[model samples]
Target chain A: MKKILKFIKYMMTYSLLILLAVFFTFPFLWILSTSFKGPENLFTWPPQFIPEHPTLENYVNVFKRIPMARYFLNTVIITSLGVVFQVFFASLAAYPLARLRWKGRDLVFKLILLPLLIPMQGALIVNFITIVRFGLYNTYIAVVLPSAVSVFGIFLMRQHYLSVPPEIEDAARIDGCNEFQVFWKITFPLVRPAAMALAIFAFTAHWNSFLWPLIVLRDETRYPLQVGLAQLNSVFEANFRSVAAALVLTMVPILIFFYFTQRYFIEGYKGAVIK
Target chain B: MLSRKAQVYLIAFSFLIAPLTLLAIFTYYPIIRGVVLSFTDYNMMLGKAKWVGFRNYIELFKDEEFYVALKNILRYLIVVPFIQFFSILLAVLVNKRLPGIRFFRTLFYVPVITGAVVVSITWRWIFHIDGILNGLLLHMGLIKEPIAWLSDPRYALCAAMFVTFWRGLGYYMVIYLAGLQNIPSELYEAARIDGASSRQIFIRITLPLLKPTILFCFLISTLAALKIFEEVFLLTQGGAETTTMMYLIYDYAFNRYEFGTSAALSVVFSGILLMFTVINFKFFRAGSEGR
Candidate 1:
């Protein structure tokens, strides 16, 4: 009787979990279905669960109606450039703070924390002023430079680096490997997981970046995907199918990128946001 | 070779201290600029900002939209936590470590990362007169008429809050999971050994231990809710005059070309966020030290 009760409870628990998972996963499945459904089939009375007729027409219309190509290119350029520069600067800066014995090191790390308190929006207020003052407004460099040294990246890398054994650095020094060589040859490889974490961090941030581009980029041609999509949203009226298509296009890269690097992204999310 | 002490000093100067001069110029400068700009009659677009001494803030004091947005925000700040706490309770049920629980976890997290725009769009469709929600409700004989969720001022804010809750719960659940993992099972085992009831163990062990994570979730949620932009913009467009401060500020800065006022509102906005940041730091610091 006890064994039977245990089995019943086990079955009940699994059944509830499966139901909960399906509930959470519903929105994504709906969006995917909506994106693929025929124009007429999309707004049906019952809302077609499966596409009665799936067509690529909405996607084709997305390209033709809007500069989807330009938006895609802009997204590629800014995210690619921003991620590369952000990681390089963050790690380069993190190297000394993590491993080196520096004066006022604790104070400096605390100061970096202050910037983390200052959200990207706060920085945007100043960054906009700086960009215009330097005549770099709407320039690609303008978009990338201000955000290059992410404090979170610096902090996370510093955490991982401080855990390295002291003996490795001492051995490198005995082999005539100077600090730069020690960092490049010995330390960098040791902190690969953290670096991977930072790369994914920078990529997602730059990809979803909307408010910054909205403020700085003026030319319609120059707008990144989020900003471009927002503009597309403003200019159109009843192209719901195409609007849905554009959204699907915008989300595809993120979904694909997340799928490929999800484990790391998950790891980074766990590390960065401690509830 | 120089002694380790000397090397440490050199590294500190080069790596940590040197980079800060740039940060001082960039991060600190803008904050000061914002404070100064808030008091001035600054315009948005032209960039020829001149100080007018408290006029912009004074004008802000009189703005009707500002009050509405503030009231809307405060309502969320006060009420959303209870809503979220309940949702999290629901999530914990789903998060039970039973068979197929991992599948449930994935389900909860899927909406968390999906863009805000898509979620808002989905919800907007559902709340339409002929949409699934109304259809389901009517089929269940819950409502006499299809409610005008988005169009009615009475329901618009409530409708937006529903979307916010739906979009946000999954993200917090994951955070809760992280906090949950930190708890050692031995505590529960000990409680069980002592013949402590399930509710007694939960109240004593889980709630107290989860306080820090709960605080963290609260802080982020409060701040994010204050700056809830994408959903409001997509769904309501600040409809029925239910504009958020961020949306209003975005309008002033980008649309109306009131950079000075925009900067002022931003200064005010960050001041609010900074207050919460201080609270979070205190909570986390105390919690960490307690351990």
Candidate 2:
């Protein structure tokens, strides 16, 4: 009887989890279905989970209506630049603070934390002024510049660096490695996992970044996927199918990226946020 | 061997140069500029800015939309605790080594990895006047009318909150899952041997130990709630009801070109954020110390 009761409880738990999973996964499935349906089959009396007549006309329309390819390329450029610079600078700055003994090290660490206290959205007005003053407005550099060095990245990398054994650095020094060589050859590679995690985080962040890019970039040709998609949504407000298609286009690349790198993303998040 | 202290300093400085320069130019300068600009009458279109003293702040105090947005954010923050609770519940459930659990975890995290625009677009469709939600409800005989979930002011903010909760649930769950892993299984075993009920163990051992992670998630979620702009912009375009502080700031800076007003609002907005952060820090610090 006890064994039967245990089996029943197990079944109940699995059923609940499955029910919740279906609830959460429904939207993605719905969007995929909607993206394939034409306007005629879009809003039936009962909305279909699976399209009656699936078509790719919406995908074709999305490209023809707007510069979908251009926006995708622009998003790629901005996200790549932002991620590369962000991770590079973060790791570079993190080395001295993490492994090396230096004066004012603690002070600099605290100084980096100052930016964390200021809500990033609240600083936009002045950041806009700074970007214009540098004559970078409407340029990709303007969108990427403000976010090039993340405090969170620096902090995360610093934490990862601290866990490395000092004996490795001492051995490198004995082997005639200079300080720069020690970092480039020995310490930096050790934190590649953390860096990979940071890269994924930064990649998705910049890819999805809307407000800053929306404010800085004036030309429609220079707009990233998010801003361009927002404009497309407004411009084609009545066309649900094409909008769905555009969303799928914008999301699919990152979704694929996330699927492969999710484990690193989780590890990196644990390093950065958990402790 | 080059043992010179100056060379050691130079290498360190070179490593620091790029990030520090960028931080100085972009972050620190803009922060000071944000404060300075707040005091002056800076208009982007006018091509000149002059000191207007407290006029911007004075005017801001009377702006009805600012109040509404502020109130709306306060209301939106209600999602923080709700998300935290559900996320913790999810973390505990998924912490088990069950079959196909990885798929369930991935499914939960899908919306989080999905960007704000995509999430908003998906939810907007789901909450459309004749959307699937209404279809499901009508099919189940849950409601008679196809409610205008996004269009109706009464439901607009609620709809946005629902989307925020849905998107954030998995993100926080992952954090809590990490926290749960850090916890030793020995504690659960000990409690089980003591004949403690599941509810008793959760309340006494799990909840108390998870305080730090809970506080961390609260801080993140609260700040996120305060900075909410994309959802309002994408879902409702700040129409009927869904205006937030960030949305209003965007309006003043981008649409109206009132740089001074935007800066002033930003200063005030950041002040409120700082207050909350400090409070949470104190609470977390105290909680950890108590334990």
Candidate 3:
């Protein structure tokens, strides 16, 4: 009797879970279906959950209509540079604050965390002025530089570093390894998981960063994937199929990256939030 | 080689220099400049900054749009708890040790990484008068005529809020899942030994243990809601009743070229955000302690 009851409960839970999953995933599936559907297949009275006649013409039009390749390259450059520099600098900054015992370290860490309260969005006006004043207007660096040093990255690394045992560092130091050697050879390697997590976070963030890029870049040639796709809405005002195709095109790389790194992503997300 | 103490400081400062310098130039300096710019009539095109003593503030106080934007943000607080409930529910449902759960997790998380632009565009299509939402509703006999989800003033803000809720639900689910995992299994076993029902255990153990995570979710979600701009820009274009504080600031600075007014508006906006942060911290802390 108890086994039957347990089985019933399990079935009920699984059904609910499956229902919610479908609801959550239906939009992406819709885009996928819409992107492949022929022009006639769209705008039916009741939308087809699956495309009756699939074609690649929408995707072909997407590449032909917009500078898809350049936008991809631009996004790659910004996301790669953004991830590398953000992780490198954040790890470096987290070291002293996390591992070493220094005077005013706590105060300095507190100062760095002060930006958490002030929304960076609110400071857009000043940042816009600052960027223009520096003569970096309409450049990729203008979009990438402000975000290259993330307080969240620093905070994440520091938390990871705090979990490292200190005796290992002491052992490295006693073996005549200098502080840099200890960090480079021992401490840094131990925190690779945290760094990997931070890298994923930084990569997806920079890849999808739109608002700052939207404001900072005026030159159409320099726009990243999101901004370029946003501009396509105006250029392809009535062509929802092609716009859907372009959306899928821009989304594929990030989704692929997420698929491969989702383990680290979830673990990293858990670490950051739970801590 | 330098003395050990000197070497320590050097290594520390070297690591700290690049990020600190960048933060100072981009973050701290801009913050100070934002405050200073709020006090002056600084036009970006005119390149002239004149001291205007609280004139911007006086005008802002009398501005109807500012009040409306503030109220919109206050009302948008509905998303915070709405997301929290859904996130926790999803997290609990998926927290089980079951087969094929990873696929579900990944599926749920897809919307989060879809980026704001994609989310806005996808939802814009869905909410169109002839879009899937209306088409589905009409088929279900919920309404006779197609509804303008994005254009109608009554539904515009609600539509934008729904988009936010949809995009954020998955992201916050991951957060709560982490919190759920941290609750040791021994508690559940002990409760079961005491002949506790599942509902009783959930209320007596899960909710109490999940307080901190709930607080964190509330903080981040509230902050995100308060700074909502991308959705407004993409979906409604800040039309009708959808203007938010962030959108208003963007309009004042970029559209009108009123940098001083934008700066002043930002300062006021930042003040409200700061107050909320403090209040949230206090209330959550008090709630936790009382528990």
Candidate 4:
């Protein structure tokens, strides 16, 4: 009787898990099915889980209707530039704030974190004007420049840097290493996993960023995938299959990227929130 | 040769120069400039500003859409408690050492990872007049007529809030899961040995332990709801009485080219956000002290 009860409880748990899983993923699955469905009726009485006649025609049509490849290239360029700048600037900026004992260090750090308390939503317009004034409008740099030095990135990196022991750095200094060498050879290497976590965070953020790219990029060819997909959404409003295919194309790369680096995401959040 | 003190200063300066300059230009300058711009008539073509004190603020106070946007955003906060409650439950469910748990976690997070544009567009299709939701409801005899979910003012904001709630679940679930993992298993073990029920364990141990994570999520989700834009922009185009403050700001500056008015709206919106943040901090402090 105890064994039967255990089996019943096990079945209940699995059933609940499966039910919730379907609830979360059914939309994407429906879109996937829709993308593959050939010219058949989409709004059936019971709804079709599987396509009756699957085809690659919608995928082909998405490419033809929009410059999907160019958008992907733009997104790649923008995302890489953003990721590099965010990680590089964050890693460098955090070093002084964390490792160095200098005048006004605490003051500087507090000032940096002040924006988190008082967010400047007005930056949306002012930054646009700044971008245009600097002749960066319609360029990829315009999209990446304003957000290049993230305050949260600096904070995250600094938290990681502070956890590095001072003895290692002192030993390097005693061995006749200069401050730069101590940072380069001893301290920087110690915090590489933190840097990796920051980079992964930066990657996802830049990959999905939309509104700024939309405001800054004027030329159609300069549009990132998010902006491009949004435009495709409007253009293909009635054409569900084409829109579904375009969305799939846009989502697959990020989804695959997440699948591999998901561990960093969880670990990164753990470090960030648990502190 | 420089002394060690000088060398340290030089290193710090060199490391900070680029990031600091960028921050000053992008972050700090904007705060001051945005306020200044709010009082002036900004000309994009001429690249000039003419001071017109109180006019922009006066016009903003007179706008009906502004209040609608404000009301919609406050109404959007209804999703926060639902998201937090469900996500904590989800975290507990998946926290178990079950088979295929990793797959389920990934599946749940698919909506969040896919980004807002994809998620919004997918839902836009699903919320269409003849969409799957309507068809399913009709087949189940839930409704006699196919309701225009996105076009009708009554249902449009609700639909947008639903998408936000759905996409947000997995994101917060992951965070809550991390919070749950931080709780030592010994507490659960101790409770079990005392013959405590699962409900008692959760209420006494889990709820109190997850306080910090809960507070953090509340602060962020509240702010996110206030600044909501993409879903409204994509789904209803801010029609059907669904305009949010962020969308209003975007539309004013970008579409209408009313830079001064947009700046005014932004200032007001920031003030609202700052007020909420202060309230949250106060609540957090009070909760911690009471504990």
Candidate 5:
């Protein structure tokens, strides 16, 4: 009797879980179906849950109609550069804060992070004026420079750095490795997990960055993926498939990047929850 | 001796020199300039500013749109925290060592990484007149006519609210699950041995210990909500008085091309957010430490 009752409970839970999964999964699935359907397929009554016929023409139109490649290229450059610098600079910044027994380091670390709480919107007017003053407004440098240093990345490296045993560095120093050399050879390798974690975080943040890029990059040629997609959505009248196709194009790379780095996904969450 | 030692210490700081230079030039410098610009009429095109003192803040209080935005945002600040509190509660319910639970978690988390664009797009379909929501309502006999989910100013804010609630619940739940798991099982075992019911155990033990995680989630989510930019921008365009302060800043800085007023607005907005966060932190600390 108890076994049957237990089985019933398990069945109920699994059924509910499956239902919820379908609810969550439907949006992405619907997008794929929409992108694959014909132009007439979009406004069909009772909206087709499944595509009767699928086509790649929408994807083609998206590229041909607008400079989709430019957007993708721009996003790739910004995201890649942002991630590299964040990890590199974060490592450089976190090392002294964590390992090197330096004076007033704690005070300096806290002070540097003070700006994190202030919203980017708060700095918009000043940043815009300053960027224009420096003649960098609408330039790619404007898109990348303000976002290069991440406080969260610094904290992630610092937290992981705390658990690293000091003797590894001491051994390196015994071999006549100076502070920079020790950091490059010994400390860097030890923090691979945290670096991977930071890479994923920085990558996603830069990939989906919208508002700042939307404001700064006035030239369509210089626009990132999100801004460019917004432009496509606005101009492409009654063309849902092309919009859907463009959306799919934008999202797929991040998902692929995510799929290959799924292990780091969980590891990143673990690393973040350390505090 | 101290001066020599200080000089050497400063000289060894190569990383600091460059980064601090960048920070000073880009981050800190702009902030100071913004504050100063708020005091003056620093028009970008005019290439000059007239100092007007506290007139900006004074007029801001009298502006009706400012008041409406403030009220809506305050309502958001009050209500959204409790909504997420309920979400954390939901997460706790299903965080048990039950079958196929991890799948549910991933399902919940799927909407989070979809980016704001996709979320806004999908939700538009969901809330359209002939869309799934109205279809479901009609099928269930809830209403005779289709409701304008984002059209009417009345339902517009509510529409934004729903998207935020749906998208944010998953991320907060994940954080709470982590917190719940970190708890030692022996405490629960000990409580059970002492004849404590589940509800009592939760009140006395679970909620108290989960303070830090709750604090972290609450702070981050509130900050994210305070920004409240992308979804509204995508959905409403802040027409029909749906503008939040962040949108207001965007409008001033970009649309109207008023740098001085925008700088003033940004200062006020940051002040409000900073004050809100500091107060929250204080309350959180007091509540957690008092018991």
Candidate 6:
């Protein structure tokens, strides 16, 4: 009887989990079903959860209607540039702030974090003007330049760096290693996981960035995937099938990327938040 | 020939030079420049500004849309509490050592990872006049006519809020889940061995331990709700009286080319955000000290 009761409880838990999962993912499933529907009446009294006659017509139309490849390339360029800059600069800036004892170290760190309290809404127009004045109005760098140094990235790296045992660096220094050698040979390698986590955060942020890119990039060819997908949304307002296909295309890569790197997200948050 | 102290200082400065230069040009310079721009009539063509003093602020106070945007953002705060409540519940639900829990977590996070554009567009379809939501309601005999979720003024903001709530749940759920995991298992085991119920264990242990995470989430979500723009912009195009402060700032600068007024609105919005943040910090400190 006890065994039977345990089985029933397990079943109940799985049932509840499945139910909530459906609630979360049904929209994506509905879009998937819509993307494959073949010229049938899409608006029915009872919405179809599956396409009666599946076709690749909408997918083909999505590629034809817009420069999907160019958008994808642009997104890759922008996301890569953003990720490299954020991780590189954050790691460098955080090293001194976290490890080295210099005059004004605490003051500089405090100054960097001060902006977190001040909202950046006011910077929108001014940054745009700055970008234009720099003769980078239509360039991809303009999209990534302003946000190249993420304060949150710096904070996260500094936290991780502080956790590293100082003795390891001191031993390296006692062996006649210089400051740069100590950072390169001993300290940075210990914080590789934290750097990986910061990279992942920067990746998703840059991948999903829309507004700034839309404002900066005047040429259609330079439009990132998010901005491009938004353009498709308006252009295909009445054509739900094409829009569904485009959304699926944009979603798959990131979902796949997340699937592999998701463990880092949970672990990263655990390390960053708990302390 | 350099002293050890000076060499260390020089290395630190070199490491900082690039990042600091970028931050100054992008983050620091803009804060002061934005305020100065608010007091001038900015000309894009000549890249010049003529002093206008209080003209922009006076004009902003007189605009009716400004008040509508302000009220709508406050109403948007209605989502924050609901999101927090649901997300905490979700974090608990998926916190078990069950099989396929990671898959379920990923499913829930799809809306967030897909970015705002895809989620908004996908939702726009579901909320269409002949959309799935109405179809489901009608088929279930709940209502005779289809409710225009996005178009009708009565339901438009509510629909936007629902989307925001939906998209935010998974993001916060992950954070809360991390918090949940951080709680030592020994605490739960101790409670169980002491003849305590699950409810008692949760109330006595989990909630208190999760306080810091809860405070952190609340502060960010409150700020996010106030600064909401993408949903309003995508779902309704700021139509049907759903314009928000961020939308107004964007509209004034881009759509109307009123940089001075836009900068003024941004300053106002930033002040509002800073005030809320200060309040959150004070409340958090008080709560922590009370314990």
Which runs of model 6 end up more than 4 angstroms from their true locations? none
lDDT of 2 by residue, B161-211 (tens): 999999999999998988887778999999999999999999999998888
User: Arrange candidates by TM-score, highest first: which order?
Assistant: 4, 6, 3, 2, 5, 1
Let me know the TM-score candidate 2 reaches against the reference structure.
Answer: 0.95
lDDT score for residue A82 of model 5: 82
Best model number under lDDT: 4
Cα lDDT computed for each candidate against the true fold = 0.74, 0.87, 0.88, 0.92, 0.77, 0.91
**Candidate 1: chain B TM-score against the reference chain B:** 0.88
Give per-residue lDDT, candidate 6, residue B142: 97
User: Considering DockQ, where higher is better, how would the candidates rank from best to worst?
Assistant: 4, 6, 3, 2, 5, 1
State residue B57's C-alpha deviation in candidate 5, in Å.
3.8
| Candidate 4 lDDT by residue in tens digits, B1-291 | 989788788999999999999999999999999999999999999999999998999999899999999999999999999999999999999899988898889998899999899999999999989999999999899999999999899999999999999999999999999999999999999999999999999999999999989999999999999999899999999999999999999999999999999999999999999999999999789778756
Error of 3 at B46 (Å): 5.8
Model 2: lDDT equals 0.87
> Could you report the Cα RMSD, in angstroms, for every candidate shown?
3.2, 1.9, 1.8, 1.2, 2.9, 1.3
> What's the DockQ for every one of the candidates?
0.44, 0.65, 0.67, 0.87, 0.46, 0.80
Q: List the candidate 1 regions with Cα displacement exceeding 4 Å.
A: A39-45, A117-122, A273-275, B1-22, B43-46, B78-102, B188-200, B285-291
Q: Please write out the lDDT profile of model 6 over residues B75-117, one tens digit for every residue.
A: 9999999999999999998898988988988888888888888
Model 5, residue B78: displacement in angstroms?
A: 5.0
Ranking by lDDT: 4, 6, 3, 2, 5, 1
In model 6, the clashing pairs are none
RMSD of candidate 3 to the truth, in angstroms, is 1.8
Interface RMSD of each: 3.2, 1.8, 1.6, 0.8, 2.6, 1.0
lDDT, residue A27, model 5: 69
lDDT of 6 by residue, A65-126 (tens): 99888999999999999999999999999999999887889999999999998886788999
TM-score of each: 0.89, 0.95, 0.96, 0.98, 0.91, 0.98
- Deviation from native of the Cα of residue B109 in model 4, angstroms: 0.4
